[model samples]
Target: MAAAAHQADRPATGGQGCRAMTGGDRDGAPGDFRLTRRQLCALPGSAALLGLLGGCAFAARADAPPLPSDLFGGTTADPYLLALRAYIWGYPLVRAAQVRQNTTLPADPFRPRPPSAAGAAINRLGHAAELATPLMKQGVAPNNDTLYSLAWLDMREGPFVLEMPDFGDRYYTVQFGQADSSTEQALGQRTHGGQLPPVLIQGPDQQVALPAGMVGVRSRQRYMMIAERSLVRTPADLPAVHALQRAMRLRRWVDYAAGTDLPAPVSDQRPLLAPDTRCPAPLHFLEMLGNVLRDWRPDAGEARLISGLRPLGLAAGRGFRLEALSQAGRAAAARGLADAEAAVRAKTFTLGRNVNGWSVNYGGSVFGEDHLLRAAVAMDQIYVLPAEEALYPNARSDGGGQPLDGRNRYVLRFGAGDLPPVDAFWSITMYFARGLMVPNAAGIYSIGDRTGGLVRNADGGIDIMIQQEPPAAPRSVNWLPAPPEPFMVMMRLYRPRAPVRSGHWKPPAIQKIGGA
Candidate 1:
């Protein structure tokens, strides 16, 4: 990614961009410098030097070279610590931008990719023709319940008018998100019931007048992401769902006014990143992050956070270059990147409260100052709706608190009249340890209330079979196939009631039922 040309117009520095060091050589003066821990550790026979300096206080030297500074001004800067902060702070924006670029750049910024393809172009919607299946590996934790309609828009020009057709009883939601992966709002059954007015969406700097009756929405950045989910009741209902998708329209305000609003042009652009969405190299990750920061206008608090990163040669509009750091700083940065990635992976399983062996996470819709949580969510499920709109409770353990293994059969039993409490729908989808659905012989990826021929006991309770092998007869009706290895189960409740949102409700545990 190239550095923006606008850098010359912005301030050369932000704030002090350094932390203060105290008890240092007894005096603070310009050019005062001391060896940081990393620098000391890098020296030969450094153990002896540490022992000698243990009881002695050395004076500040005016001759020391200006080393890279830490977030908090310490006489010695640790590049590893600074890099970790940069990764956490920039992951969401970097990931979002990468998706946008990989999806939209293929159309040369002029057209949208076909819905059947992986992604859409900038300023257009790409509707997925079918619901997600095990074969679909484009995204993490793809839902099997809804057909997706994705769009990456550039709102810098003006507000775009998003028109949604009325559906008397269909359950659907259109989620609008900013460049930083923070959901601005979601429009669907819970918010608008069966009907909604057109929404006019603009950027933070855009000063546009809304057409009468059109709802106004603003994004914090020039780029925005739109994710629409239209529930598919059954396989036979796809045609009707496709028709509804075709009726949805998003066009520039200028085009809508001049009567030139037409569907997004069909095209395809080869993505720079791989289809698997694997983690990019550490240095490349920072470089991509710097590219995104160039166009992003963070809020006040975030601005302060970004300012502290300037010491590491990362600032808005400036390219994060390798030559900007010393040899030692570069090595420390590499270690920091690795540590940050591992931290995010570890934190993902611990989000929210653990109940009945499930991690019931809430407040995903809006993330404020919780950078690690935000990054973790982005890594696992990028665009989840709010808890009121939906709650995702995933389990890696069984009722006995043992890790779930597909080699053993398990059962999830819900008492009579104790089905998940939701205003719209509920479903349980199976995934491998890495969060992707695995292919099974049964061709079943998920099971839910809308599942055909789902059986309930005579007493009104439900027992869902979970295993790698196909079960017989009555049990087969409730079977949710799993991979023959370690796996996880995610229960999704759409339009959850207050009970689930307040953590008062919990799903039944998955019990080990003896097929190993």
Candidate 2:
């Protein structure tokens, strides 16, 4: 019962048999589905919960679904429920690990990694020389407005020094995330303003002397993911952003203290996972979670929750073990994981308020104990900034509620003075399913207030054309080309205004045009 939220307006039955609004799958994983907070709360009882999970796993089988309760004590929950909760609790940590592993692994010749992948080994910084194109596949919901620089760090080694260049009023942020997928620190224009400072980053147990003019920041975990984003105003601005990215530096305490001439060699650590690998079996997935958890010590609250999972072959310090689980036990665990995967994908549609066919996703990386929401966010779009820093309002359908298809022409019209209100900037990016960029002959992936050659009406209203073929004449100047298939669009507002965040100011609905 602690897993579900109490909502006065939502039915207690969890909207069973309703036409669920679905979100995109993760990493193109087959048969993966997402869930939302409302849907999660709608789960009626244990029977209902078990039915949703076990139903997906055993739909085609004639035999009765596996009995998860058989594996546990009389008072404890069924293994299916325990494993489902565990999956929700550990999704972020495990997904983050997958991304970290893929980022650092050497790109195999046979496998074409996402063009935008960091591709840098551990402790090495990899900068994207240009903004993301259609071919980029590094992260979910990739934004074309900013170029990225990424790194994976083992903070147990020592304190690391991070330096930021003078970004004179440009919007930028360097997000440091812990292994458990919580935000450690985010430094940039919003928090630090124009005058940026050098930082000393270290783990909780790490302590080192900071040099003069350096600030110390400590993380709760030893494994860290450093993702830095710099705004790219236009195609020509790549060089300028690249320069700032190059100026940024991360070095071990020893290297910085000794004034080492050469950068420290990347640690000789090999990634245990391969790029674009199939999602592991449920047992294998839990084993991976166990291995990651062994390196991480949970806090008091986490320890309490994790303690309950011991009966399901999972403990905080000890990794997941298969030696004792019976064949039935394994099957139950597998069903539990499969159910969670489906629930996550099925519930992603309601992460935040939806107005005029657009979903304003909230929560970002600061999910405090709302594990289902966290897993849904991780599944749909990982590593989003907190709502205060940025708001991503996206849509996969038209105002009429039909799924957006490239076969039909559409227009996104902003009435005079109805542009998205934000302190920094805004952009509407075109994406295929799973947030991949839409490939087009025009090489256009996004358009916004900052987009050059944008033509507006005499009343100052802007009309953005969305279709497969280019529009004729002046309208073509505002065209955002889409693939000749189903697609989605996301509007990114950096430093969004209170009106947008509060849902008082809604984005204009996208209108389908008559016969193309």
Candidate 3:
């Protein structure tokens, strides 16, 4: 059958006999065999998809047993797939109207002219939209469905209506949660009970609304919006609910933008934008296409085809059977593992870019050493502030500069006048070149305001030791241990000012202090 034709119908369901084998009780006890209502609903779809895929393979090799229920063991792959399906269906619907609205520029007679600054803002929105599709497709599931719902509401109403509140000079981050008050309450507690009151203005009492100039306190750095109300409601009321939501969203965005000196917020006093309503139909068809692709055993050509269609398919709001998608993802991952193993066997592996200044020559595939390379490229990248720009953007190059050999013992000295400038705090964190948190002998991978018991020098200068051993006396307060092999560092400055952002201050190049 053609791919599209195969996916047009749902997978064939297995009978009770097949279920007794895979979904049966582990202990083989009589009472343990009962499947709960939720389990039954999930099982039919899950088993059918798996059985169909397994049957295809089995026909080719008669000796092959059916695919195992525990093919990926007790890992998170299953749950991740469920979340991915939800995200795929949820995000595009949520953001569809907003993306369309933003994409409709001023010169287009159909829509009002967005401000000149709208181009950059729309670009960022598009980037977010582009990222949402692929990121959702990756094995990692979203923490919640709020992002999806919010995008849907924006797409239905207009992007300009959803508002992010101004937090004044304070740094802030957006947190998403269910539309009910729970997520907002959690955010309030985290921000010391400083959040806007829940404004669920819907139904008969829903006010037509006006620009409610700066709705919340300027000092509040965090904002939360509960989109569940609109998501859970019937589709008929979605546009109205989205309209109210867009108003609030725009208000918040304006307040926040004004505080940050960003572009003036768009006014929403006019009538609601007419609904497009036609986009979802085509997208529904594309989702069916994705479902079929997930069932096929992927080769290189198939992988490329799926990857290319991923963004377009997701934008069109395709939903896949979670279990099927997971099985397909695992198959793809196995191929990647094979490729990596092949490279290692051929001894033709390229060291990651950051490995240039850091010598990684295999010592007969047993041990290797390079002191100077260890010190300079210890961390993949380092951030220095009161200099806002990242200090090390390019990977360390071997021929570019002499390595600062400090394998066993290293010292980083900051004079009294050289303290990092920040509105809130600063810290230097260490990570292995592989990007995992390093396991150091001293249990120290970072040092900053949060690191307890740091001692300062007599003249207010701080000298930190980056080495394997414990330092003597006051020197212990400044110790950040080194890994036996390669590593890297990152310095973070919270609430950084212009000087740091503009790179007015530069951190001194790391130097070798003593012999290894």
Q: Which candidate gets the maximum lDDT versus the true structure?
A: 1
Q: Rank the candidates by lDDT, best first.
A: 1, 2, 3
Model 2, 329-407: lDDT tens digits are 7778767765665565555665666678887665556777677777767666666766777778888778887767777
| TM-scores for every candidate against the unseen true structure | 0.81, 0.81, 0.34
- RMSD of model 3, in Å? 20.9
Candidate 1's C-alpha runs over 4 A off are 1-77, 105-118, 262-281
Clashes of 2: 12
Off by over 4 Å in 3: 1-315, 318-406, 440-443, 450-460
Q: Over the stretch 422-466, how does candidate 1's per-residue lDDT look in tens digits?
A: 988999998765455668877898898998787888889899999
Error of 2 at 6 (Å): 36
Ten-residue stretch with the least lDDT total in model 1: 1-10
Residue 411, model 2: Cα distance from true site in angstroms? 1.5
Model 1 / residue 388 / CA error / Å: 1.2
C-alpha lDDT values of all predictions: 0.67, 0.66, 0.30
